[model samples]
Target: MRRLKWVSIVAVGLLISLSGCKIVKNPDPDSAGQADANLTDEARMAALARDIWDTDVLPTVAEHLVPIDDLRVSLAQNEQAAGQSHGLRPEGEANPWNFAVSGSGSIVEANTTSRAAKLQVDTTGDGAADVTVQLGPVIRGTAIRDAMPFLIFTDFRDQIEFAKLAGGLNAMAHERLSLPEGDIIGRTVSFEGVFTYRDLASAPEVVPTALSFEAPE
Candidate 1:
């Protein structure tokens, strides 16, 4: 019993010595605060999107834009040729070709039921849908990013960043957009934006950076 008591005392002493030698200080609060202050990937991309939207992105879109009416004809004749002329795609990449286009049309249909909403535009004035304009808080695809010549994929850290930038740009555009509260069928609208499709046979899904609803005249 005495030996056990002596061993217990030695064990306690050793533990106390070890604890004294290894000081476990709390982590520096400032370091943790600084890390928290750092911009998240989404914030970073959104800032980048805002920085470039007017100065770089808009100008680039204008430079590459083809009229929807003309694009339809071009696609009908030779999609590859049209894409080569008006679209942007990496030389050897399998990504879909992206194009900037402008058109004014009547809103024949507004599918606002889905979060991935779309407006069917009748550009021809014949009361049929010519193109689809994406109205998104939830947008799909990276058409804008792929279309911009200046926003090279290699310029970003990786595919995730690039994709987020696309989303940021889409969100930025959505921020500027002001949709009409009531029914908008037959309302005249004009838009300039980017789009992508797997084949020329498919209608363009336009992600409008600029969308203007014409005042009834």
Candidate 2:
């Protein structure tokens, strides 16, 4: 009777321990506590830009940002001026508003399967950009990452489908982008309008840095 009781107790304990294996293996050992480490200066700045793009940019400009009727034109009454152009500075007038975006890219968070990226917008015309917008930080399996889910809105027809607009937006949110702020969080900004650019580096000047600001249709 003693042997049988001891065997039964051991079997129960083993089963309990085995049941926890799933829980123990759920965490990625390489990723444990890594989220808190101080990213290198380059890494931190890059991350800030990315956060702006993911958290700020994509949602704002996607089809739903502005009313279906609003996005019809390039500019809007509420939109802010981009400043003067670089070349024909009108003699004394401050140089043309030359803004550009460069080094745009993305980063994927392994654990949550979320993605973050940087959207560079320069208005000064100089190679380096003045303002930056981070957008996304989009979670995996969300409407943005996968299929489009219908949401009630004023003009769903004009609104760019969430998935369809992701490619161009992602192209804008490249990995190597930069921003003036070392730490970018809790900033109210906006980006709209369709500006053309040749490549990430040589794009147009002083283009708005949307900073994840939604599109104003």
Candidate 3:
């Protein structure tokens, strides 16, 4: 009789636990951390850019930085294989593969005259740029926007709004980038940047999230 009573109590406790559980059907991880719906479009764009750059971009790159040399070698073999190994392209995305890369190299060229200012980095020590990093009042390409796997195209109202978000992110990059006040020519600089390349043949055009120069020696 005592054993039966104990079993009944255990059964009751199990039933209570089951009653408290709620099943979430088809939960989307990306949607869980989306921008505030109440925010204005302009404000939402800015917020998304900050969230992508500061919260997602930096930490994700820091954890999975691909070396320049390895990238070139892998990319030569095959684009799909290279992307899977060293970078990311959203599932079923026909877009260029986006990569997070870090390397120290000399700035062979600086085009500060143009509003779309850029530094040509020679990471291979060969006198030519292995990659071009945009430091911009006008940054080109959708590298930052593309790097964000969470910001799905369908999430935005339309394609035009998506383009605006890209523009906002470029503006954010320009605002954050700090270059040496003096001549930056031939300066040894280290950077953590993101770039997307459609073709395997052309050099990467990167958008840096973290860039710093080594003090002149």
Q: Each candidate's TM vs. the true structure?
A: 0.78, 0.21, 0.76
TM-score preference between candidates 1 and 3, better one: 1
Q: List lDDT for all candidates, in order.
A: 0.85, 0.34, 0.81
Arranged by TM-score, best first = 1, 3, 2
lDDT of candidate model 3 versus the reference: 0.81
Q: Give the clash total for candidate 3.
A: 0
lDDT of 2: 0.34
Q: What is the Cα-based TM-score of model 1?
A: 0.78
Candidate 1 backbone overlaps, count? 0
RMSD list, candidates in order: 6.1, 18.4, 12.2
Off by over 4 Å in 1: 1-37
lDDT of 3 by residue, 8-52 (tens): 999999999999999778645457344365456777787777767
In candidate 2, what are the lDDT values of residues 107-217, reduced to their tens digit? Answer: 111121225443444434344443333443431112222212222223223334433344433434433233444333222234432232223334332222243422222
**Residue 11 in model 3: lDDT:** 100
Query: Largest TM-score belongs to which candidate?
Result: 1
